[model samples]
Target: MRVWAKSGVAFNGVIAVVVGLGCALFALMAGLAWPAIVATSVALAGIAWLMTIRQDIRRHFVVKHPFPDEWHEILNRSVSFYRKLDEPAKRRFERDVQIFLGEQRIYGVEGQEVPIETKLLVAASAATLSHGRPDWEWGRTRDIVVYPKAFNDEYDVADGAKIAGMVQEHGPILFSDRDLKYGYQRSADGYNVGLHELAHVVDLEDGRADGIPGDLNWMAAMPWTDRIHKDLTNKHGRHLKRLLGNYAYTNEAEFFAVSVEAFFERPKKLEQRDPELYRLLSHYFNVDPRTGRVIEPVD
Candidate 1:
């Protein structure tokens, strides 16, 4: 299996090179001391190189250290998505999990202890989503906060609280521990808090949660927008409600998240019931959830 590099390594490398050159040029134009210019360039380059290689260093250790047997047991027992992976893909998934856990922090709210099991589940959700797109990475700086129970919009846990999970645009992801466990327990229920919220993150990649992910070609974008409008307006309301649930109709972002849940949890049904939607999602995600096989789009 190819070792997974840390996310944004390439982007950071480019920034490092540009900054070093820019600083050196400015220093020379200002007739600053040669020694100081060289020092600035070297320091900037060194920092960038270190940032770029951090993931490689972590990947090397991940390769040497066998994935924990206990973690494997948990995935096998809990993640239906993991069970569908082939051996090579499984190894890749394991490596991705380790890298994610190494980089991101997961803490319990209200002093609730987060077990290894829950941590593994969080990583598994990420690995499952990015399995086909090996280059995709969760932001390194984000934290996963676990609430003891569902919380209200005000971010408080109460008897009438309704939110099971939420992803802030520039803040940490909050998940109800109760909903998180239940989502996995009923894996085929078409509702996974982890996948649902992460889907929002995907939508927000372009700095907006408008149900459109980044890098979508205009060819696909037009159709996607049309479909979202059609579904939102109830042109296919009865069928959509049966496949995805009423929450999907709440908004385009919610529809996309709900569709992601159905795509993985009930892939064949989604394909059979809504072939075009399945095809569009498969094109975007680059994998067939039903077969766990990567789909190379034709140009």
Candidate 2:
């Protein structure tokens, strides 16, 4: 696995080099005649970008807790399922995890600092859900506000109802730390409030949270909608007692978020129960949880 991972990194390096050369040649043609100097500068810039992105990605997927060694064992046991990810994916996950954790400020209702382990668990789950897409828009929405426990905020009930955490039209995310920690520690069995809310953030990427990722082209969007709707109907109609969760059936946006949690937390179960929905998610995310591999889908 290490050799394979090394080879993959080398391959990416080669590609980056080729792209750098191409950019330099283009610049020369456009009158920046210093080919050698230009190529070298561009190559260095490319390398820097790649490194930055790698760190950013790792920050989004892995979290480090300030606890004793014994606690590490417990956290590992809690997230043992994450071993399904290959090294490259794990690297990316680590970067994303760090990024996710770095952004959030966790506090108790009384304004005390929450335990790092609690925040780590919540951030880990968020990283797992968002890891599939390197281009995920929510990746840029730094700062997750986690309450030590379930807390409430003033909401305009007349407008859309606000649950635990909400992704405002243009605002930071709100989360119940107690709910997030409990949900992820329990093997992500029930609805993940973190993922649920993050899903809403991703859906808003297309400029509106209308239950659609506008970033998805029509081809991807069609299948995504079809499979999700079919699964929802089957589960809600009593034919399938609920492969996802009841919250998923609340609306299209919630359904997308709920599906994301299931995709990462229980890939095999989801595949066994709803193959089509699994396939759609795998396609859109460009990663297959079942195989921990990224390959283009054949038409």
RMSD of every prediction: 4.0, 7.2
TM-score on alpha carbons, each prediction:
0.83, 0.64
Which residues of candidate 1, in runs, are more than 4 Å off?
1-48, 215-219, 297-299
In model 2, how many backbone clashes occur?
18
> What number of clashing residue pairs does each candidate have, in the order they appear?
0, 18
Output the number of the lDDT-best candidate.
1
How much does candidate 1 score in TM-score?
0.83
lDDT of 1 at 208: 74
Error of 2 at 194 (Å): 2.4
Which pairs clash in model 1? Answer: none
Q: 245, model 2: CA deviation in Å?
A: 3.5
Q: For model 2, how does the per-residue alpha-carbon lDDT over 67-186 read when each residue is reduced to its tens digit?
A: 345444544665543566667665555555555556555554445576777666665666655556554534444456666555545632223334556677667666766677666666
Candidate 1 minimal-lDDT segment of 10 residues: 1-10
66-126: candidate 1 lDDT, tens digit per residue: 8989999999999998898889778878988888787788999877799888888888888
- Cα lDDT over the full model 2: 0.62
